[model samples]
Target: MVNDVLAIHNGNYSWNIAFERGLQDLELDDYALLLTSLHEVHIKVGEDDRSKWKSGRDGIYSVCTYLRSILGSTESSFPWKMTLTVDNLHRKGFYVTEWCYMCKRDGETNDHLFLHCEGVRWLWNTILTSQHMDWVMPRRMEDVLRAWSRKFRDKDSGLVWNLFPGCIVWCVWRERNIRCFEDQAKTTEQIREWFYMTLYT
Candidate 1:
């Protein structure tokens, strides 16, 4: 699968394909991590394929090493050092349009695009109404997540409820990209349907 997306270019592995859809914030971070991890990998011609456990000193697999590799050596951070939001792009000296693509009424920021835009608010309200839950949206995305986490603790609905915010944000972001880059927009109903489809599957 990796070979399908990568190619040996000038004796070094390079990405040879483009993603079908724009990557989300977290997905972009993961992609960065992947590239970082692969930076040192060298391909040797005429060599047999063999598995080596890099986590162990002897390149041998062990239970402790395996567990440590999976658990990691330190607490993971959000890795939000940078984002692709218009505000961030402006900070990076890219002079793109400042207005929000979805609503076009406010400057585009991470919070406004994902949570606070007029259209985004309507989508959030629709989700809450479907669950018969009333919520006062917070000023920040972190606060909204904190509030949602506190409300749902049950085993069944809680899991789906916990996933709802992420699902909504992802769907909204994809729609935003479609409108910005492709000059195409999906109706609120279409966005809602896309969110539900993404959440369940």
Candidate 2:
């Protein structure tokens, strides 16, 4: 799974410390909201899978495929940006509408990629007890993010596990941009590798 590969989003030094420090500012309701919406079960893995940790992590990568997005109602996936959909709205307005690059659903936007990408289905499975997450994919990214946050909210709870999801999402979007404008592309492996590089070091 991606978490096993590029496991941390490290662009911002002290990011973990900062995030933890800010936790105190949250009210009990914020914590409750966070937990209620957290989809922690989406990452459950079989006990047998413990052995394939590294392999699972590496499989989350796309080593040879070019990062490309199919044409849609929007002009291009260049200006595309995905942010926390805390209240059921993307950071920007949906111009024409889009579908997830990996899922090929009716609507391919930030939420789809975050919560429903089959590309990351294996990764999500690591959190769910069922050993498969895509089967019962959440309706939106906000739910996934909050669920992830709540599940790993504890300091001793491996909350850093969130880095994998956040980094993959960011890297995928970055690759889409590079492909659209620079006419450049990277294999999924390269993207996964770069995700680790850009996010951590």
Candidate 3:
């Protein structure tokens, strides 16, 4: 009966008839009229499914909402960390040299620290391989988020996939700080283990 209500893959059944039958099968006669009210809903065929963010008028997640979600009294978000990188710090009077604290092979930028550096690339590739995903790393943050959201369709996989970019951003930035301030560096295995432990529990 519950499966009847969730028969979204029933291509053989006409949409309205299937929905009405599903309601009757579930003994939801009380909701028959209410459910029928959704008949006017427009579903564009041959289009990718898009889930909207209820909080945003545009049906897309806004930066304000993202910031609110990840921010706490003591913690900032991944984007905030990227904004305050060593390169940006130099501009703001922190007087730090502009080199990726992670790899130190190239100048630091948010993209380099989060996505492009060889060490970061190795870390991301290892994680993706573990999940049996073969995604190409995007050069920009927005592209990465778009790819993750589009590719992972199942709830559990999508949730984990959605968190990976932000987690990697935060972890990589933290590792950069440890190298610069705490005089410590971590191997790729250590970083991978830390990410998995943080993600699962």
For each of the candidates, the C-alpha root-mean-square deviation to the true structure, in angstroms, is 11.2, 22.1, 18.5
Off by over 4 Å in 2: 1-107, 119-136, 150-159
lDDT of 3 by residue, 121-187 (tens): 8878877897887987777766676566545568887788777777787688788888989999988
Determine which window of 10 residues in candidate 2 has minimal summed lDDT. 10-19
TM-score of 1: 0.60
The digit string of per-residue lDDT tens for model 1 on 1-201 reads 766876766665676657899889879888888777776676674466688899999999998677677556633222122447798788778998779989988998878877899979998988889888798888877677666764545787878988888888788878988898999999878887888899999
All candidates' lDDT scores? 0.78, 0.48, 0.70
lDDT of 1: 0.78
The lDDT-based order of candidates, best leading, equals 1, 3, 2
RMSD of 1: 11.2
Model 2 Cα lDDT, one tens digit per residue, 1-201: 334322234331111111334455547678667555543424334233333222333544332221222222442322233242222234444343344444445455565555566654544554454323344666765455555544544675454455656666677666655654586777656755676586565
TM-score of each: 0.60, 0.39, 0.57
